[model samples]
Target: MQVIDAMHKITSHIRNPSKFSKASKLALQLIEAGSVKPGTVSHFFAILEAAMSSPGACNEPSVRADYQALFNAAQGVTECFNQQQKKQFDIWVLHAVVANDLFTDDSFVFSKAVGKIKDAISALPITTVDDDNDEAAALAAVESKSGTTHNNTDDNAQAAASNSLPDDSTHAAASNSREESSDPFGLDGLLEHKSNKSEKAREKTVAALNRKADEDESKRFLKSQREALLKCLEIAARRYRIPWTQTAIDIFAKHAYDNMNRFTMQQRDAITKLWNSIKEQQIRRKQGKSVSGKLDVNAFEYLQEKYSHEKISIRHAVGGGGERRATQWLG
Candidate 1:
């Protein structure tokens, strides 16, 4: 995967660069605390900064795919948490890492811890954010209910007492009856409580609608990002000869497209295996096992057959071409 493009895709959802910076700082703190591996921290900073501050150097080119992918998911999830949640989340992560005995394999420990952190954060309820629309609607509703209820109650009481009796004693009795009938069983209190509940319900509905809109918009944004990244990868692979074959590039590119979020380290492992499969053959050939040091015929044929499709070259696929020509070398 193209590191820069992948970083952009992973972090594109972040509106404020400060949020990303804050997330990176939290990860850095985790690193310092020894909750996770130190190997990937520098890579994290490099790739993260490069993603955030575009045109910035990705100093650590040696960063592994697992680190890149995990950090991306972590950042996205962490950004969802509010300030208090984030602080709690950080503590939980540190604790989880220190107490983690489940993954004794060591090889998969970091990923497991990250997964645990994500699950924990996901379980926490999202804090409701109030907006002006919800507040205004609630205020308007409560005010309308109170105003109409008070005026109607007063008018009904006045009319009931006046229509009942003209004698002083009877008028006093009618007035007492009116008061009792108006809210005989504390219905006034009940009505006010119910009005409050209705206000709350309206607020909740508004919040839910806003949340849904945000989620839909985020999905659309990520979808567009994946499509654009896929197109760019395809264009790059078609015109120029990449170190890896078209099949490998296509496989990963399609994956990046399909799975825009939640990239797994396993995918990276698979790519490495493919790279090694081809690279090993090239090494063998250079050691006099074959004639060429550039391409391994056996490995190429095996992979091409395994991922069979009609190959299209850039020249025939499009009218024009990129200026850079392919130079044969191991990527």
Candidate 2:
């Protein structure tokens, strides 16, 4: 059977205590013989789990005994292998132990095992083999005790070329000298500085002109839509029985001011009609009729419904009649 299959069988048998003796014997023999592959480290932990879960298992004394036996078997196999093979084996065993959550407290044992493996590998003679050649013999000996082939001549030339570049400190000093010689009072420097200043001034002037043009266009638009928006506000306010205060007129003016071009000609006409109704409602409220505030519930509800379709909230309408408060209503 494949190694992973064997490991699974062993783990299963160990978890079921009736099969513990058979499984434990097989697992111990396989591990001791160093037949487990590095890729099967995960499977090794499965076996460990089974062993730890068996009936009468994980009792401190019994667990410690089993651990010692396993440790000894791994050490024996490690000693019998060549250095490279032994390192691979040790790595697999260490991975298995750690994966199983064993050897967490007793780090000394792991440290000693690592030290022995390192020493064994270090003692092996270095071989000279070029991996880039890729012949069958070289491939077979790839894992043999050997250091990589070194090309000193090419490395030396690369090192010299790297060292030949100017360092940052020297470059900075040279740049400073060039700057000082070009302009003493730095008037050329001052002109260079003023060039940017003039450019920024030009940009600011252009921005101001554009803003003024936009403001004039906005004024014309508001003048055009003024009657319509006021009419709409009046009608909406009166329909909801809300009073038309100066505050209400101001809110309508602000909406006209900000959104002059946004409304259709029809919408503008509707707004003028609404505002006239608001004026009538105000007259009624002043005459002691029971009317709501300047912003009627219906007007608020309309704005809310309209903006909701655009994902805008109506919270801004609470005290301000749905108009942004930063700017004057007509301005």
Find the candidate with the highest lDDT and give its number: 2
Which ten contiguous residues of candidate 1 have the minimum total lDDT?
322-331
Instruction: Give the distance in Å from residue 215's predicted Cα in candidate 1 to where it truly belongs.
Output: 2.9
In the range 9-48, model 1's lDDT, one tens digit per residue, is 3345322344444444445444445433233322333333
Q: What is the C-alpha lDDT profile of model 2 across 1-331, one tens digit per residue? A: 4888888888777766556556667888888666665566546645654564321233233344454456446565344443333333333343233222222234444334334433433332221132113222322333352313321322343335335423445545655765677565656655557555654654554455445434433332232222222333333243242222344344543444344334434333444545555566668767988655444334434432332222111121111322212122111
Off by over 4 Å in 1: 1-187, 193-197, 210-214, 217-221, 224-228, 231-239, 242-331
TM-score of each: 0.26, 0.22
What lDDT is obtained when candidate 1 is compared to the true structure? 0.35
